[model samples]
Target: MAYGYTGWGWPTGLRNGMGDAGLALGIIALVLFIAFPLAMILGVLALIFGGIGHARARRGEAGNRGQALAGMICGGVGLVLATLVLVLVVSTGDEEPNGRMDEGGYSATSVR
Candidate 1:
């Protein structure tokens, strides 16, 4: 006997696609968290898509609630980490060197 088609396509629906995209972006953002600019961008997109997907799932418009939630959470954490790294770099960029080096490759300033 031949099985009948269930009529389900690859992505199924827009909301499902959003959930899938969100999950993928979230994972990428997390892995690239060291690159703050890229991570932030991907994280934001993941959050937006995941939020919409999750809302749709909750409303019975989609069926990937867990994936959406995971994406949102990972994106949020990655964004936070990226922001923290940015802050750390900015905060330390203006510090002056502790001491000047002499021709002999030793500190010119003497300890009191």
Candidate 2:
């Protein structure tokens, strides 16, 4: 019997394609976690795609179950990290500088 051959034969290319995309997006999301919001967005997408891939695999309609699982793992971790960063930033209130200068007009102390 062929290895990894399901009785119903191989699933369509699209099924595996989603798994591949999920894996790639998951990796990207993990790497971009430093970007906070963007990472959260990518992580969400990765999870969605991974879920689809996983469903197909569970139904014996596709391969790459490992990839789908990996995607889900990365997406979950990345999303959590991004959310923490966002929360920290919001709580810390790291807003832009007020950009107010002294009215003394080019004082020596200001230059120093």
Candidate 1 lDDT over residue span 1-112, tens digit each: 4988777568545457788889989999898998999999999999999998998899998888999999998898889889988998787665557643334544548634
**Candidate 2 residue spans exceeding 4 A from truth:** 1-15, 94-112
Residue-level lDDT for 59 in candidate 1: 91
Q: Please, what is the TM-score per model? A: 0.72, 0.70
For model 1, state the Cα shift of residue 35 in Å. 0.3
Clashing pairs in 1: none
Clashes of each: 0, 0
